[model samples]
Every structure is written in structure tokens, then in C-alpha cells.
Target: MDKMRVSGDRFVNERGEQVIFNGINLVEKDPANDMITPGGDRLYEQLATHGFNLIRFGIYWNKVEPAPGQIDMAYLGRVAAQIQLAARHELYVFLDMHQDLYAAKWGDGAPDWAVQDDGLAFNRSGLWSDSYFISPGLHHAQDHFWANDPASDGVGLTDHYLHAWQAIAKYFLEADNVIGFDLMNEPFPGSQAQEIVQAVLGYAGQRFQVTPDQLMAMWLDDTAKQKLLAQLNEGDTYSAVLQAMTPAVQAFETQTLNPFYEKMAAGLHDLLNGKALFLESSVFANIGVPSALTFTADNSLVYAPHAYDLVVDTNHFESYSTARLDHSLKVIRATQEKAGVPVVLGEWGAYFNQPETKAISEFHIQHVEANQWSQTYWSYYPEFFSSPTAAVLDRPYPQAINGDLRRYRYDPATQQFELAFKTLPGTSRIFVPHLATVELSQLAAQGMRADKRALPGGTGGVLFITADREQEVVLHLQIG
Candidate 1:
């Protein structure tokens, strides 16, 4: 129940109760801003005032290390400051090494040195393929990832990645303010099912001798990478190839994913035991198999599935559908059950309002609410900060604060607003974001339980309060 600890099982609060609530996703479009990259303390504090005590924070891997073996201390310092800010706000921080489509250019993942040239020269301005507006490098890596022969170092990249994480962990070893590391954000396993299977096989054969789909009860970080590398080539014989691939794949499953959890947890105890750690498995249900993994302990550990309706639907594997979300639950529930951790739907939302999505979302909300687990929508954003088209509330973000943007679009070219906002309403602070439509008080009525209240500002603002039953919060809205 202690909030300081998070294992392979549950996210228990200091009271030893499993924690659940609506939270914020904090990543800045403008790195120059004081929050996120430059000065995030203000941003953190702002989010706190708006009824958010949990935050999904993102950092690009390349920003930390533009070159292999070289880590930017200044960048790490910036991140540590953000971590401190979260603590000050009494918010839970899930520091995410986020990437989209993959590559330093795409958003943030591998350093420039990690770019793999697999002959994928296709370019895309805004399209979702290998080429890029800046360079073909980002596109090239994306191609290989989907082409199935990902040059993830298979060994080298993973090693550098782990080491980079270790360096970051060292700085925040004593910070009890943050929650856990989300490891890698979204990993694509492309079109090669056989290779995917083989990668796991190789992982098992090399590291814990795990059988395919077996629990890697004992995983050793020291030698796992080497074992994986040894098996990447397999052998001239196809059987040898299969055997090698098994351990490689299994090794990746356990090591690439879980070791991050293990290190963060172990470091907290050994180096900074008071801290908590949770694993955000690769992209949720990208494949039918969920990538969620576990650390040693079974308490306060959450295996998050970043689900999109379309991803779960798997037909377009392209369109988003909440109704199809159960497909994700079914694929991933097994792992979470085995690890004995709550299944955290790290991200979920509808691109458009669909009854099926609503039903599926309700099911998910009920599941999380029934068990008191927490899940967050895909994002939180403002319109004026960027192009109105890019706002979390404007187009695609599954906003929880306010909804029905078609009627809310303040302008024609832009449907979204600007800068994730929080305001101090009158006597009672009330918060209604531009996109959030879910009524927390109403949800409570439906048996979906969470610490929620209707803001005093009739439509938009929130009163911030600490975790105390005696705390009285009220907000007053100012109508235009």
C-alpha cells in the first residue's frame, strides 16, 4: 500500500491503496518554454491547479544522446529538474522515452548515430512512411522496422539504450517525486511474424532459457545482450536459426522491456529505494501480442497498453475503434494477469465519436474503475500554441475535459485551442478543458469510481487540493 513502491503487480499509494485518477500528458511543443525542456516547473504547477496530479511526461532519446556513447548532461539536468517539478506538484510522473514512427527525426527515440540505412529511401512530408521532410534517414529506419529486419543493434542499440537509462536513473535515484520510467514508447514489429517469434525465441535461448510464452522468472542483465547478439545470426541450418531466434525474441521480450523496470526498481532500493517504477510496454497491441513485461515485485507495478481503436481493430489495423479495444484486453490480459499487475491502458481515445468506441471505452473505464486502476487519454494540448489543427482538443486527441469541438471551434482554420490551461476560478475553482466531456461526478454515479468533483467554475477550471479527506475544494466559473 505504500506509495513509494511500484513492482510488477500494482501501483499502490502511500496508504497501500491502489491509486487511480485522471491525469495529464506533459510534453511541450516548444522546447524554449520554461516547462518540459527549458523550464517545466511552471508547466507542472499549472497542470496541478487544474485537477491533475498524475502526469505522463515525455522526453526524446536523441535529445539526451545525439551520438552513440555520448550523453548530454545538460539535457539530463533539464529532465531531472522536470522530475523535481512533478514532486513539488504532488503529481505522479511517468517519464516516457517517447517516439512516433521511430527515429530521432520522427519525434524522439534513437540518436542520430543510431539511424539504420536499410535502403528505405521513401520520403514523406506528413505521410507515415520512411522518408522525412528533413532527411531520408528517419524514413529509412522506419522502413527497416516495418520491413522486419530492424537494425536495433539487435544488441548494440539496446545496450546503448539501457546504459543511457542507467545514466538517467543515477541522477534521479533519490527522487521520490516521480513514479516510473515508460522505457521505450512505441516499438514496431513490422511485417515479419516469423522474425518476431524468432526474436523472442532467441531471447529465451540466450538469457533465462525461457520457453516461448514462458515467464522469464530469472533474468540477468549482464549477459543477456551478448546472448541475444550471439543468436541474431542463428546458423546456416534452419533449425539452428529457429532455436537462436527463439532466445533472441524471448530475450528481447524480457530484457529490452523488463530490464528497464528492473533497473529502475533495483536502483530505487539499492541506489534510491524510495522511488517507484512502472513499465510501459512497447506500443499497445501493435501485434496481437502485448509487449507488457514485469519487474521482480508484484505490487504497484502496472503493465500499460497504449491502445487505439483502429490498432485493436487490426483490419485497417489502420482505423481507431473503441469497441475493438476488447481485442487488446484479450491479447494483453494474460501477461498482466501473469505478472499480477493492474492493466493500465496507458492511452486510449476516439478519433471521431463512434457508438462502438463509446461502448468499448465504457467497458475499459468500467474495468479500470472496477479494479481502481488508472488510465489516461492519448494527450493534452492547446490550440493557439501551435497550428489550431494540432491541438489535442482540436482534432484527434481523446479529450476528457471537454468535447464536441465542431461547435467549439473558435476559428475556421483551427478547431483546437492553445496551451494546456488551468485557472483559479472564484471561491470554488472549476476546470472544463476545451475538449474534456466526461463528467467525473456522473461517472461516479455509474459505478466508475475515481477522485472526481464537478468544478465550481461552471464550465472550465479546477480547484487543486492534496490527498486529504478534510480538504474542501470549490471553483467558480466566469461566463463570457
Candidate 2:
């Protein structure tokens, strides 16, 4: 099959079937080393067995171009092997040029030569993301990249980055499963990040009854801010602070981040002519901020945003809150609707496997279904597949729709599934994992005929429904 293409508000395959990309992020992203784990081919098969149809594969720029203007074909060849494996297992691949804190020296991204920090001391906080606000080195490195500053070879940094992506595109141009390129992961705001943080802190203080001067003092004094951050890290909700900062951060995204995306889009225009370009807003956009990205790539763009509750990464799993989730979804959906593009939840679910986390995961999945949006979960580590949470992570979903999907729901407790869509002439397929028993006798749909068959290798079942005309069709699968 030809790779999926963006068609207005959905991804459509060559058959013109709307594809709901369902999968996880697969990356061995450690600061000290970057390598695809051995036996990764088997992992791809494992994902397929669990009914996942996509993998947001992480490809580090540092690994792809270890030196300035160097294109490491050998390293790319290794990554290509993984793509081929995914293709063989019938999975789509979204190549995510992943980064955190700008460089491997700090986290994982641009190589050492690209990190031109103007003599600022490198510092880190207890939380990994705190560096975005506090570390001068990260700010400098990000500033240089955004400015498209010259590297050691006098070639502009972004030019080198684009060339690296071009090479990747050329390498994978023939791979049918290589569906798209996630331009960058959580593109952070540099230089003015501190200002943005301060704006947020000041807003928080005003709402929380703390004085602006005191907030400034706490922001300046690392120990004081860290103490407050520790409270947040311990699951103290800061809804007022996060809500207040939304406009400031959204402004930064509009003023700064969108232009960067435009530059990248211009650079990759020719190379990614037929492929989708997955764009993300600032990491702050994950909470609840309207994205400021408005690009001209009307047909090939996807608003690939991440979402996590405020209590994310805390030791305790906060109970699922519909109001909180609804607010974030409303904000995110408004951004997608404004850009006039399909929304693919690029990443979510980074919590541990506690009872509350399980409920939160279910809530997130429910929203994804309710919104009729595609998503790839946060990750796929070996332990994650074996953990009890996997039961919730892996479930039955409509893989390919013959037409526009109206809504879908799956009750894990009862193993029941329901889907509604406007009918077209093609076959709509739903993945039915082992835990769910969907007999043809239990299937119900109007103006459609349903058939049940085992998936490849007999790992699971697939409910295939064929519709005859252009009308609304509803499918119901009761657990046997």
C-alpha cells in the first residue's frame, strides 16, 4: 500500500480509507547512548500482535549526523532496518526527530558542535524539564538553533538539520510504511523561556495570593522555586497557574515556534512533497493552550499535539477528572479546528501502572475515541507490554474506516464495542485483540455485512464490515 496521506481532517490510505493510526513511541532515548535495542524486529511483531498499526519511531539528530554536515548512512541504515521490519509486520512509521533540552550533552538532540552556548555554565534541576527554564546552556543552544546560527563549517544549523532530514527522506522514500515525519518533538522556546516562566509564576502568585515580588524572588532563588515545584511534583494541582500562563505560552508559540516550523516546512517542502508533516506546539501546549501554529501546508499537515494532566510524572496517580480533561481537549480541538487539519495525539500516557493511573489512561483513551482522533501512546518498553496496564493500553479499535467516523466506544469491563460512521463502498476493519470475543453472530449493523476472521499469525481477530451505500452505519460487537 502507498503511504497514508492527509486528506482534510483525516489520514487516508491509497484505497481512500480513513486510517486511524494506533500505536506507541519506540525509542531507546537515553542521554548517554542512542541505539535501537537488539531484537527490535521482534518488538515490531509484538506491537502488531497487540493490534497496533503504527510506531512513532524516534530518530535522534545527533545520531544521524554525529559531525557537522556529516550524513551517517550506516546509522540511518540501522534505523531503516527497523522501518522495514515495521513494514513487514504491517505497521506505519512516523519518524520523530526527537530532542530534549537541545543537545545530547544536556539530554538528547543536536550534536556537540551544534550546541553553541556562549560561555554559559550548564546547570540542571531535579526535574529534567526544569532545564528549559533554568539552564542557560539549554537556552543558548535553543537560541542558536532558532536563529539558524552558523555551525563550525559555517553552514547554518537549520540547514544542516534540513539536509539531515532530506537524507532521511531520500533513504526511506521507497519504504511504503514510512508514513510521515514528526518535524521535532515538543519544540521548546529558548532565550525568552525564563520570561515566559516568570509570567506564569507571576500569574500563579496573583491567583494564589502570593505577591509578585515574592514570586520573582522564588523564581530567582533556585531553592525556593524548587521547593514549590516539589510540592507540584508531589501531586499538588496548580490549575490556576497553568491556566494563567496559557496565553503567554501561546503567544510565544505563535511569535516564535510557528516561524521555526515554517522554516522547517520550507526546507523539507520538496523532500516531503507527498508525506505528512507532524507539527507540535510548545510542551506547555500539552496542558491546555490553543496552538499558535498556522502553516500553509493545507493538505499535508497534522496537528500532532501531546496531552498530559497537570499531575503527570508525580509519584501519586491523580484520579481522573472529566472537567480537567474536557478543558484541555476543548483548547486542543480549537487549535486543530483553527488550523483546519486532522488531529493526531502524538503522545500521552506517561504515568506508572497504578489503579488511578489505569483509570486516567482509560479516560484519555475514551476522549480519543470520543473525539474520533488517532493517537500513538507515549512508549513501548519491554516491561510496559508485560505490565497490567498493557491490558488497558492494548484493545479493540477500528483500524481503517471506509468513511468519516462519527464516534466509537469500547467498554473494557464488558468487552463490548460500538462504532458509527457514514458508509462508503470499501471495507471497514476493526482490530479485536485476544481478550475480546467478537462472534459474527453478535455483530449488528445496518446496510452492512460483518465478517470475523483471525489476524495474521492468528494472534487476534479482525471484524470486517462491508457497506453498500452512502448512509450512516452503526456497528455493535457484544462480548461472547
Scored by CA lDDT, what does every candidate get? 0.47, 0.77
Candidate 2 steric clashes: 0
Q: What does candidate 2's lDDT look like per residue over 132-245, in tens digits?
A: 777887888888888889998999888889888888888887777888899899988787777767777677776557887787666555567556554443222555666567
Question: Candidate 1 residues 293-312, lDDT tens each?
Answer: 55455354557666554233
Clashing pairs in 2: none
- Candidate 2: lDDT over CA atoms? 0.77
Candidate 1 accuracy as TM-score: 0.57
Q: Which candidate is the best by lDDT?
A: 2
- Output the worst ten-in-a-row residue range by lDDT, candidate 1: 403-412
Please report how far candidate 1 places residue 183 from its true position, in Å. Answer: 1.1
Name the lDDT value of residue 193 in candidate 1: 29
Report the Cα lDDT for residue 96, model 2.
94
